[model samples]
Target: MSLRDRVISTSVESSADPVELLSLKNPVHFLALGFGSGLAPKAPGTFGTLAALPLVWLLIQPGLWFYLCLTLIACLAGAWICGHAARDMGVHDHAAIVWDEVAGMLLTMFAVPLNWSTLLVGFVLFRLLDILKPWPISYLDKHVHGGVGIMADDILAGILACVGMHLLLEMGWLT
Candidate 1:
């Protein structure tokens, strides 16, 4: 692996170890549960979002309102978890805390069809917008701090992803 990749991997691995991670209080543990997905050698954000898919799928089944509620809760909790974890690690937006991605992905899937094609498209679109940080997402990433810092950009990306997915659905392109 490349030097940068190796370093990020090491950081993520170290941070995600439950033994090491659980020693922390509330938010830290949640952040660690996201695993090292947030610290991928490349496309960490995309990896993080992908890592959340299984869990998101599980949570989304109840209904759109439930899913959206869960998304809001996750977003609020993610801020705490990410902030605490980042503080413990003595870093700003450490690569290991990916709960933000979890929340974002859930938001992206909100009100969208639960089919494989839609899920796949949502995942891809969310990751793209997240990585690109278009418009308000980019602005939020720069301007926000703490838990908001960790969660805001991804939330905005999720919104964009949702819009894209909705459009695709309307166009019958997701089938």
Candidate 2:
């Protein structure tokens, strides 16, 4: 059965499988899948962010302004794509839809110049803040709804990570 059929049947209910979302025909679904990175059974969000590294690296190659534009596009696009995909899936913030993570990671690395060590620390910090959802991040995650809500928390986490990473760099802690 097609993904549409599967979604509509309602008779043969099944669990939300990340891989199963790939069968969907919607362009938004494909986008929200992070080009299939979200199919990972474990840590799909991490996998989606990992898939974003090369693109983020390329975006930064042109310098910060260009990177910001690209990251901005991702954030805007993520809200639309993730929102549509979640609605289609009949689930809120389904695990299979991780374009939010890609956008989040891109935002996380925005302030820092691309480097192996910098990327490593940023990754850890982004994941930590995203998972921990400190202060305003947690507040948004709880209060917000829909795609904006899904993406907002991560965006805040990225901002926090970028700030933290920048502070650490300025402190001569990591280069």
Candidate 3:
């Protein structure tokens, strides 16, 4: 269903806590919650980003085409996963729904050489951009709606981080 339809069709009381509604058994929720990493009581997004490390390691192994294709698939599919989970929880971009972070981290590390320093830099950069939400990123977060809305800001943050990583590489600041 469209985000507008879901919003109009459901009424979540302000007093009602939506976290209780999340069920990991539900595959949609499982993926949306970053394989349960998003369930962390504090900084779920951080934890969710951390959970992406293994994925980053794995994606970096194959050539760029494979990595890019898989990451693209995740980003596209994540939109549906996140939107469906939000609809189920009756919340918009709930903290527990962090598949966007997973996708963001994937994008952040794209094509960057796998190493401790690069990994750390990408992580910090993506997280900072995601949290600070500057300019166009902030604009997309506030203005966009539905699955696209939930994923747009993070995607941009990931792209920006990816660019930063490339810059660091080209500048010989990181190797």
Candidate 4:
């Protein structure tokens, strides 16, 4: 089959098995929240971000540098993995591939304290920036393609979210 056909076929749903949904052996499966968020007919990205929260919370306590490093790794790896998966499935940046969200949230919380308010703000900001895709992010999203294209905009959004979160924290606005 052609590459595009493969991508489209990979995204097709036949069953609702949770195990099958979460399996990432195929890069696409690994990315689409194991297909969990992908299965959602509405707001899959939001669900994907929410699904990543627990992991992001756990990673945040290791220190800002560690989280930043992890986020970077995820972004880099996600580009490859998500891209491969998308190609395998005959698609581009599938909704089920939420590793981008995980990486983005990690970026958002990089320097922020681990608290509900901070987490909430980071979540809102990251999601808003990701969805809005402003400035360089929007530019990158339009101009870039492939694995880098899949992951670039979200990474930029994460950076923006991190900046916004830090500002809010510094100003004591979140407390």
> Mind giving the per-residue lDDT tens digits that candidate 2 earns over 1-175?
6654665454246654535544546677777888788888899888888888888888988788999998999998788888877766667788878888888899888878778998899888998888788899999999999989889999888888888888999999989
lDDT of each: 0.75, 0.82, 0.91, 0.73
Ranking by TM-score: 3, 2, 4, 1
- Assess every candidate by TM-score: 0.79, 0.88, 0.91, 0.81
Candidate 2 regions exceeding 4 Å error are 1-26
Can you write out model 3's per-residue Cα lDDT over 12-111, one digit (the tens) per residue?
4454567666789989989999999999999999999999999999877878899999999999998999998888777899998999999999999998
Selected candidate, larger TM-score, 2 vs 3? 3
What residue pairs clash in candidate 3, if any at all? none
| lDDT string, candidate 4, 58-109, tens digits | 7767777777777777888888776765566555676766667777887788
Candidate that beats the other on lDDT, 1 or 4, i.e. the better one: 1
lDDT of 1 by residue, 15-71 (tens): 653234334335465454476566566666677788888877888778778877878
Better of 2 and 3 by lDDT: 3
Range of the 10 consecutive residues with the lowest summed lDDT in candidate 4 = 13-22
**How far out, in Å, is residue 18 in model 2?**
7.3
Alpha carbon lDDT at 117, candidate 4: 82
Worst 10 residues of 3 by lDDT: 6-15
Per-model root-mean-square deviation over C-alphas: 7.0, 2.9, 2.7, 4.0
Residue 7 local lDDT, model 4? 38
